[model samples]
Target: MGKNFTYLLGMLITIIIGTILYFNLCSDCIAGSSNNEVEQVVTEQATAPEPEPTSYPFAIANGDFDYSAEDNFNFDLSSANLRLPVSEKVDFGIYKLKDYLAENAGKVINITGLYSSKEANNTAFPNLGLARANDVKNYLVKLGIPSSQTNTFGQLKDELLPLDGVLLGPVNFNLADKAEDESETIAALLEKIKTNPLIVYFETGEASINLSAEQRQKVADISQYLDKVDGAKCLVIGHTDNTGSRATNISLAKDRADFVKSYLVRNGILENTIESSSKGPDSPIATNDTEEGRALNRRVEVTLN
Candidate 1:
């Protein structure tokens, strides 16, 4: 009986040892598998590629017309100057926009040019923003768009991000139909001209004349008015400061008046529609005592009849 009991006890001990060894080996294998999976996930996460930067395309859109391009007009930092991009796509889009405008006679485009306070105003305008807007307007006008159908203004922005010191798409366009009465619009324009007559200043001995952006805009408005009203005449009067003899001053004033008349004729106005005369030293808007006043007096005043 003692020998049988010993044999059963030894068999039971051996069975328990085998069971423990099998469980330990399985645990090691499971741990190794889990580690391999974690390493693969870490590698994938570390080697992932970064996303590219977002791009903003320039666009011009109206009710049913929409055009977009990768590039548009660009300007240098702190400059009122801009140049159109030399891309076929951009040119095609602009031509399309022009055609759309021509089809809609009542549609007027308002160009709002953006500028930062940090930019310097080097143009002969009230601000850099306005100068930039006018530049764009002139470009459109040269492309056969009526200056009367387009208006320009400036907007001040707190911040602007530029690429390589160039501001892309610095202007925004808004096309709106003119809703005011025609007669009333003409009356308002005439009143504005009366209140703020277009004046051209001449240097001491400079014969060649260069008009500022503001002056050019005034000329454009005047041209539009003349086209609208029949038999309306433009009067260009020249005046001079009291510097030389009375005869010499009178002759200089007359020359200046003729010069202005020629300028108007060159800009699409008929010579017969313009009347030029010299006031000499007789009419002085400013005192002839100081250089500043004299400079102001040496000008040609343009008015409409």
Candidate 2:
């Protein structure tokens, strides 16, 4: 009986040990499952973020679009972008948009828009308003294209609507939805002149050169500036106040342009690079009846030819 009692105690101890081992093994399995669940949650959190969208500042929308910037990353909008629409509403000559494009060595420009005519000589067919959208297109591609960054657009027609005074003022200065994010060499030089024309002018009207002088320097500076351009030729146009008679004004305007051209030639500028003209009192910048207007009128202007 003692032996049997001892055997029973041993059996009980063995059962207890087996039960404890089973419980420990079950606990380890549960811990492993919990660890795997935590790892999966961390991995899921890491990979589920939002992505950003791509954008183009001067994005081409319409089918008729062409743009050029030597290094597009550093492009100026003047010659860095071009767009022209294929529409009958466009005029070939009056708007002079083609001339403007040619002058800038084929600036990248968009030719599709409600155009107005500022043609020096009105063409046989005039546009509805003063703008010539189609002429700009054909001129860019057909006539004298320096670059290939021009295009036409339909969506922009909606965005640039209703030409009111205040809105028109800001958009006139080659303004874009966003600033160009690149550095274009030609556009850079053009922009410098557009923004700060004084850097190329003398004080008022003296037969001297001053890169630092304002107003008159635009003429002399242009002569020096042409060298930096690839294939630049300019029309040096002269004008005068109505204070003088038409004949006298015309003569004075011619003299003024000649004087400028002579100075440029003296300074080693090629003579063929510039063409001279005299508008006299006909194309007064302001109402010449006023002193300020007269002064403004008695000046020379350089147009891209």
**Model 1: pairs clashing at backbone N, Cα or C within 3 Å:** none
**Residue-level lDDT tens digits of model 1 in 1-305:** 99999999999999999999988998899999999999999999999975432223557777687888986566777786676544677667767878988898888777777887888766545556666776776667667777667766778874666766777767777778765786688888888887898899999877876767787667756755764566777889899999998888888998998998897765445566689989899999899999999999999999898
RMSD of 1: 13.8
lDDT of 2 by residue, 1-305 (tens): 99999999999999999999999999999999999999999999988874332112222222333322221011112111122332222333212444555454434554333322221212111221112232333344454443244433211221322222111211111212212532365456555565544311223456654332243345434433454464777667788878858998899888888876675554334577778888888887589778776777777665554
Which one is best on TM-score? 1
Error of 1 at 201 (Å): 7.2
lDDT value, residue 132 of candidate 2: 29
Q: Each prediction's TM-score against the native? A: 0.58, 0.33
Error of 1 at 60 (Å): 2.0
| Global lDDT scores for all candidate models | 0.76, 0.46
